[model samples]
Target: MGARIERQKNILDYTLAALLRRKRKNAVLVLVYTLIVFLLASVVFFSRSLQREAADLLQGAPEMIVQRQVAGRHELIPLAYLEKIKKIRGVQAARGRLWGYYYDPVVGANYTLLVPESREVAPGTMAVGEGLARLRLSAVGDDIEFRTHDGSLKELKIARIFPAELGLVSSDLVLVAEEDFRGLFGMPRELVTDLAVQVRNPKELPTIAYKIAEALPDTRQILREEILRTYDAVFNWRGGILIAILSGSVLAFILLAWDKASGMSMEERREIGVLKAIGWETADVIQMKCWEGLAISLTAFLPGVLLAYAHVALTSAGLFEPVLKGWAVLYPHFSIKPYLDVSQVAALFFLAVVPYTVATIIPSWRAAIVDPDAVMR
Candidate 1:
């Protein structure tokens, strides 16, 4: 065992020396390899982080949401629908929800208006999201005006500003009283944006949703799991698009790898020839090449992953944030909690490190199998 370990140590030392001998060439290779790894890691990390954020935010959401459709477009659901939903056997509770969108021309952005069910907002006061507060430069007790549906302006005092940590979901949100919501949108009291439903048993969510659909044919039931799945699909689709766009860079790296595998420089050939001539076996030469490949791969991959983590978890992936997060005027500012999956990193390692190592070994093995005199000539 000691002999084998010592042999490997010597081979690794030689590998490092050989790499340093061709520092310019290996440095360029490492730079390109690191760049490709960085791009791929950025996409993966950003997409996964967004998916996690969506799931975490939706954890406290209603089990099911019922929306009314008119001519294939969403319309205000009548409070009457709440009664119908409550009548469903598996439904534990059902209530009408008031919400809508308002475009603020001053900021050139849209804000979400909602009526809180668990808390109260005074009729003449409202709570605004951090993004809105920042945009309007407004503070608590400050009045902001909204033009009602009848082209009349209504002003409400800012009761509070939501915490910045909730910006992922609450950015551009405005929480108002039910009366205020109805008056501002000119909606009748008998109608609400939708119905939020809770099921008695979590496992019966699907059955409850089907029953709700049967009871209200004009209404669509959205399950919490379905919402989560939609978010996952959207993030995955966006990540796939980004990877596709960066495919050219990946191909370039592969070509560079292929070139390294297919041919060796005259100096490299002579070096290997000399090693074999000096009694080094073919296996030893191949092992040394493997060590060289591993050194370069580690040199590239470690920094790439570290940089990607910082970019996504600390800086919010500023490079690819817009593409992955979607277009929005009031973009939320929040940090993505760092998440690492061993399987994902392992897969990336195999995809990147293993192939290059194998490629390096194959060429060295091919050259090592030949007679030293002939190789030198």
Candidate 2:
């Protein structure tokens, strides 16, 4: 066993020396390969992290959301619908939700206005997200002005700011008292933006949604699962777009590997010939070449993945952020949580390293089988 281990070590040493001998050529190949892996891995890492964040944040969200549509556009629902929804058999609770978009002209950004159900937002104070606070240059106890729907300017003090964890969802969120929300939006007291429904039993969510639809034909009922699926699909679409952008890199790498396999330079052929002429068996020559390829691939793979992790999770994927997360004046400045799964890494490996390894095999064999004396001449 020790002998086998020692022999493998020797082969690895030879691989290292061989790779260093062609450092200039191999360095370019390794750098390009690393960049490709970095781009691909960044997309995977960012998408997966966003998906996990959505799941965690939405865990306690309402089981279903009901909205009213008038003439194919969303309209406020009357409070009367809440009573009807509450009377449904499987429904444990139903409440009217007061929320709307508040477009701030000064900042040129839109903010989500919501009234928290559990707490009473003071009439003259509101809680804002960290992003909104930063944009407004306001903090707790600072006053900000908003142009209301009625062409009136309303001033409110900042009660608090949401923590950073909520940044992704609340980057432009504004929470205020129900009366304040209605006043800012010029909405009548009898109406609300939508309805949040909680069912007594989760298993009957579908049936409850169906019954609500039956009761309120003009209303659209959105199941929580459906909302979650929508988010998942959206992130997946964005991730696909990122992959499409990097597909060029992928193609270039494939071409590089193919060129290496199909056309071995005279120097490479001569090196293989010399190794075989010096009593290195065909198997030994192949092993050495395999090690050389692996050394390059692995050296590129590790740093590529690490850099991608830092890019997505720390720096928020600087260049790709607007592409993947979308561009908005009030876009979230939050970084994704660092999450590196073994399966994802493994998938990347199979996608990248395996192909190069396979491409090297036949060419290495072709070189190894040549007549050493004739090749030398």
Candidate 3:
């Protein structure tokens, strides 16, 4: 066992020296190999992070949300609708929710205003998300001014700011008092943006949603799973598009790899000839070439993935952020918590490292089988 280990050590040392001798050629290969790994890792990490953030928030989300549609557009539902929904057999609770979008022309972004059903904010004060606070340069005790949809300007003092951790969802959120929300959005007291329903048993969620739709013919009932699935689909679709765009680069790299494998330079052929002429067996020659491929593949793969992780988790996914996150009038500004899934990294490995390593095999074997004396001539 020790002798086998020592043999591998000697082979690795020889591989390193051989690769260094052709540093210029191997460097370009490593750079391209690293870039491919980086792109794939970035997409997977960004999409999964968004999905995770959605999942984290979903745990506290209402089991079902009911909204009224008039002429195919969302309209405020009457608060009285909640009374009837609460009477449903499986519904444990039903409450009217207040929320709406406020477009900020100053920043070319939109802000979401909502009133918490269980908590009350003072009439003149509100809570802002970290993103909104940063954009407006407003902090706690500072006032933010907004022009109401009806052409009136209103000011609300910032009572608090949401923690940075919630930025993914709350980056543009503004929590206001119910009365202030109603006033600023021009929503009447009798109406709310939607209805939130909690079911007594999770298994009965579908039944409760069906019953709500039946009771309110013009209403749309959205289950929690539907919302989660929608978010997953959107992120996945966007990620797929970005990956599709990147496929061109990947194709070019594969062509380069194939060219390298099939078109061994005269010098490389001579080097293989020399090795075989010096009492090296065909198996030994193949092992040396395999070591060289592994050295390059693994050296590139590790750092490529690490940099990709930092790009998404720390810097918030630089260039790919817009693509994976999607374009929004008001985008969230939260950094995703770093998460590593072994399966994802393994998939990237098989996609990148395995193919390149395998590509080297055919050429190595071809070179190894040739007559050393004939090749030298």
Best by lDDT: 1
Model 3 weakest lDDT span, ten residues long: 325-334
Which stretches of candidate 1 lie above 4 Å from their native place?
373-377
Which scores greater on lDDT, model 2 or model 3? 2
TM-score of each: 0.96, 0.93, 0.90
lDDT of each residue in 336-358, candidate 1, tens digit only: 87678788788888878888888
Candidate whose TM-score is highest: 1
Q: Model 1 scores what on Cα lDDT?
A: 0.89
Model 2 Cα lDDT, one tens digit per residue, 124-204: 899999899988888799999988888888999999899877798888989899878888888989998999999989999
**Pairs of residues at least 3 apart in sequence or in different chains that clash in candidate 1:** none
User: lDDT of each structure?
Assistant: 0.89, 0.87, 0.86
Q: List the residue pairs that clash in candidate 2.
A: none
Question: What's the CA error at residue 376 for candidate 1, in Å?
Answer: 8.1
Worst 10 residues of 1 by lDDT: 257-266
